[model samples]
Target: MVTFLAIFTAFLIGFLITPVLILVLKRLNLIDAPGGRKIHNGFIPSMGGISFVVGAIISVLTWFSMSQLIEIRFLLTAFGLMFLLGLRDDMVDISAWQKIGGQLIAACIVVVFGDIRFSSMYGFLGIYEIPDAVSYGISIFTIIALTNSFNLIDGLDGLAGSVSVVTFLFLGWWFMQAGMIGFSMFAFILVGGVISFLVFNWHPAKIFMGDTGSLSLGFALAVMTILFVDSNGNMNDYEGWKFSAPIASGIALLIIPIYDTCRIFTKRTMKGKSPLAADKSHIHHFMMRMGLRHDQVTITIVLINSFFIGMMFIGSNLNDHVLIPIIAVMAVILGLRLDVITLSRVKKIHRETPPILSLRERKKKASKPNVNKEILEKVNLTQN
Candidate 1:
């Protein structure tokens, strides 16, 4: 009951303060303009993430039943590192490379000091065991991957923040069940903070979380479920209470972003493009291009993410074999949907361009001389 109250109170405080902060940022001209690939709007303050962070941090620190300073030294260090990195990027746009490097650095700090590492995947990949060195390497890479996955998913208003609220709630609950009360408190505090911010951050957003907020929030989430591995080198204990519940819940919480990342990488690589290259090809972008408005896109993705979370949770209770097939089916469905969105299809179709047109034929059309050139030339001549 106390936990619930803390979560509710934290969210209310955040929600209550978000509008005031947005107004302040707007008055100071620290607002984002509707330009480029960003959300369409005149200008909105992009500091909602900051407010959420502040609200959650203060709430937890002030009232959490944890130690005065911090129980885990490296945890605080890693968070501080991410907060600084995020705040800097938010203020002055940093390149993606820099962001990647920063996340890696923070992960390494935890790896070295806190010793949070993934020991195994409980035979998810059919590997029953792994070595310590292998465990550390895999865990660090996984942390970075998961951290960026959350950040990349923040392309639409309310999508990232709302999904996060759901994710953290599940994680916090799992933590409590596992007897890790401090961590559970952290998760609820996060949920409260983000929900509060989302009040003003919904569609027709008055403020954005910007990179500062997204990266920081992603960092916090990443640390919660990301760095911890099986610790043991066997799958026999993978289903242990602490291991299975936290692992399964964590994956479900993040399945949306992780699945999307994998889909994008595969699609891009198959098309002879670099996976790291950025384009408006994300799942959210495809839905928007399909004529979904900001709020609709936000609602659709949030609901889908929630569905996936529920499905994954169900799978977690079953055998690995059953879980694998379920995941494959979901992946196939998402892949087909993504394939339906293409430049050829999106182009204003003068006619029903064949669905299976070869690249050669497409390029041939590009190489062909414009038949309407004379008409355009005539029109230009008349205007002149």
Candidate 2:
């Protein structure tokens, strides 16, 4: 079908373009160096997001018409702006406020121009219809917050791309079932791009998506979420496929990133630190401290997200008021448990590994003398 072809085209383009981008990024020395919050070794090419973003754009344009789908233009426009902002930040790191300002502008374009704002809360706490101004504000906040949430989770190899693939797959299938072909196409197209990128972005990753992929893809996911909530809210009870707790269901799909971001922000604020200050307080970081490998942590988080999505489907009969609270409680419990267990593991590791030995191990891990000189030369070619 046309949909499958679009996905295939995007996949093929991403699969082909990623290696070239990796080569170019390394040649240009546009690589992420491991230090501080970064847990990787040596240097790895970044901004590899360009490959998949271009692939998705080309694939969408090849099959979708602007005239027929006017909103698609606005969506793509906002997407491009987010991508550019992220690409710029990746090249020469931008201040946090500047990045947020860019996200705000992109969010405004989608909400004000594309009219993708949430119209209702679907009876969560007896709130049905929202005021226009309130709706716009909430929608814009949601978009920007979710955009950063996804970006924040891009800490581990394959984490962001894997989460994205899971989100889009669910959204695409749901959109198709909801009779929204355009939305389904949009989701599936990006799904292909991210999946292909995962080929080079898995454990021992050769490349990172950087902000380029995270911001744009996260923005797109936010847009789809708004659409999903709005469309589901308007559905009648006669529609057998309609979920009673659309808002909660959408939250379930994004619980991992959203919950993690909110928790980290709160923890930082309570400790009198800037919420945006980069640290290892993330759930993934804690999991890693608990001795989980990169791939294992990524898969575990993905499974956790899938579990929430499955719960949403099974609890379709529940209203947002009940289901949302339950989800929040569960998330809080899970986060607390993870933090407690990781702390114990960290203490155990400290006890097992003497401080002198730890320092030596850190030095050995940080310096990769065994790496091929030719490979280093190839990556640092432009330096000379």
Candidate 3:
């Protein structure tokens, strides 16, 4: 009941705050312009993330105690830093390195002050406990990787928000079953914010989450993922919430973003281009090119993500060593097939379209209107 109220409060706050934020952003002339590689039309406000941030923070502070506040002070501080960084990026574009540096700083805060580093590998690859240095390194890398993965998957309307809702809901349910009310509260609070934002960010979007939302959301998910792994690794006798392969389950839950990022990076590197260079090669873009509208693409991706989550549940009894490899292989195969299918479809489209004339040919053809008219008359007479 308390959990439901928390989610509702956050939702209501987000619902009420978004329109005002949109209006303010419009008045300030802070909007994302559509052109070249962008899918949206016209100028839409890009700071809708601020509403979710405000809503989630207000709900968290209202429900959590001072002790709980202290426990998560560093995480909150990191979130604030990420939000500010994203706002700055949205307002004035920042260099990729600058954004990465900010992410690194936020990740370090959580790892150091929050003490949320991964301490064990949960017996994957025949490794159980790792060195402290190694743990910190892995934790920092995982945080930054997952953070950017979420950012990269935020291309289409409602894709990021919808994917996030599914992830948090799954995590929230697991946390509740594990009797981890605090983490569950955090998950549902975030869910509420993202869900409310989705109302304005659906197809034919009036507002985009922009960097403000993506960065903050990425940071939050990264933190939650680390916590989820850490908590599950330590749980031995938890009846309703024990996983034989927590890391595999986490990977399954985030397969879409993780796999998509890897696919894009690999393709970019192979083409001798910077991985950060933006292009219309994202999975969502390919799906759109295959004739799926924005809403259809979003729904399809969400359902795919849910399917992976279900697979994880069904395979929960499997060993980590066995399950991780299967998931990885499946992801790679799926990505390869998507690329192949998209290319095939693109070729089919080109074949179906009329051939284009060169400039010289077009000019020469235009100069001979009498011959073209005669040909057209003959064709019309034949049709008659």
Local lDDT at 65 for model 2: 62
Regions of candidate 2 where Cα sits further than 4 Å from its true position: 65-68, 238-240, 355-384
TM-score, per-candidate, Cα-based: 0.80, 0.90, 0.90
- Which runs of model 1 end up more than 4 angstroms from their true locations? 67-73, 227-250, 338-384
TM-score rank order: 2, 3, 1
lDDT of 3 by residue, 1-384 (tens): 778888888999999999998899999999888899888788888978998988999998888777667767888899989999999999899988998899999999999878888989888888889999998899999999998889888888999999999999998898889876777888899999899999999998889998899999988888888888888877885456677888888888889889899888999999999998899888999888877789999999899899888878788888788888989998888778877887888888878866666656878988975657788899999999
- Pull out the clashing pairs in model 2: none
Best by lDDT: 2
Which of 1 and 2 is the better model by TM-score?
Answer: 2
* Regions more than 4 Å wrong, model 3: 355-384
lDDT of model 3, residue 151: 89
Q: How well does candidate 3 score on lDDT at residue 32? A: 84
